[model samples]
Target: MTAALASENLASADAAIHLGNVSKVFGKEGADGSYRAVDRLNLDVARGQMLAILGKTGCGKSTIFNMIAGLTEPTSGTVRVSGKNPFSDFDAFRGKMAIVFQSDRLLPWRTAIQNVQLGLEMLDAPPADRKDTARQWLIKLGLGGHEDDFPHALSGGMRQRVSIARAFATNADILLCDEPFSALDESTAGKLRAEFVRLVKENGKTAVFITHSISEALEIGDRIVVLKRPAMIAYDVSFNTDTSAEERTLIRGRIGEVLAA
Candidate 1:
């Protein structure tokens, strides 16, 4: 095997995610009823690489995530994390991965810091330690002052920041995000994206992010894997650049061509 493949296997044995020829079909049987949301998808994400999956709506990008997250199983083939099947070892697998859904699923009654502490609580960390850790992450995400505020009291962007902080605080090796910045204003989204990219890189965490925004994909991903209609990988492009106005424009043009084609 090549070095990359070998490394992928090792990471899979440790904390990686692998999907082999995975397919998800919805609808009942017997009469033109199968809807293939994901078809023969194959992916190997290493221990610390930030990978992006980009596609239009109904293209099965989120379906792929659902399978990996163990929220849903594939109709065929396999999905594994850290050498363990998510379905068979759901609790163990969940410890190795954290997900931030598009919606900020924060508890309405919980304070921001308490919401961030929830993951640690699930892990059974001591309350003091968990609260301290949660506070640090909230501060990291610029939510220190609002830590006592409830979810409803915060703005949408602030709530999303708390959600992101909570996910990172889990200290899971793999982070899965589904259109996390979609609801934020452009400027706030841009800043959050940059900060998130920095955090992932600094922590050496593996990530599979689903986003419709081409610019967001290019900005955060080490590799952008585009899912065309019917759920096949249409383009897999590597991006290596510091975020800049010129780079953004150039990447936008390239991604436009790929989507247009």
Candidate 2:
């Protein structure tokens, strides 16, 4: 790999995503109109770190991811990838990141490998190189045999896997996942979660995941950040050390308390 690839790998191992004093407001200001989706949110996601944002519905978790993906602009503050603002120059910012939304958003007519190649297509990567890169990721995600299968032919879990492979195929340093595994069955979801963690670790990609399941968050997050009603960061907990069985139970209890408060 070249020096740039080496730096991408190294950065992915440390801190790849950062949100500083960020705030977002929707609608007009007046007695009749106004809503603050995010409020002065300050968070630092180290490269290679897997951070999960847990909150009740409508707590602005998705909004935060949107800002990071440059899909929506922050009303105030900033979102940075490698110290550059994602909002100021979205194209450049996006070159360093990829987002997997709640929906798979796969092209129905395309085969699994083709869908994975779509990212490279948008970036205008050479045809032969894109094909090789796409196949590599599809195989990495256990979709090697299904490379020629279309979205409709695969199961839900398999489809989601394709989505993930596509995201990683971009080789982006940061991965923004918004409830990507929320729609699957418990067993399937759990399996995918484990696989996701493994992929992040292997690729050294920094990730920010949003989920409503407390168990899911605890299971995969290196750190969990909770958002309370009206959208504010209520608590931030790190789970860097190996978690014991008892510790896992305790963490779940703590998350319950935060949600209940």
Q: Write down the TM-score of every candidate.
A: 0.90, 0.90
- Across 1-261, the per-residue lDDT of candidate 2 in tens digits comes to 999879755653444676767888898644367888888887878877899999999999888888888788888876777777777778795547888889899999999999999999989999999999999998988888899999999999999999999999988888889999989999999988999998888888888999999988987899999998656888888886676878878888988998999
Model 2, position 227, has a per-residue lDDT of 94
For model 1, residues 1-261, the per-residue Cα lDDT tens digits are 999989766655654788878878897533496788888987878777899999888888888888888889888898998777887678986447899989899999899999999999999999999999999999999997898999999999999999999999989888999999899999999999999999999998999999998878887898888888778888776656555778667767877787777
- Per-prediction RMSD in angstroms? 2.9, 6.0
Count of backbone clashes, every candidate in sequence: 0, 6
Worst 10 residues of 1 by lDDT: 7-16
Off by more than 4 A, model 1 = 1-15, 242-254
115 Cα displacement, candidate 2 (Å): 0.4
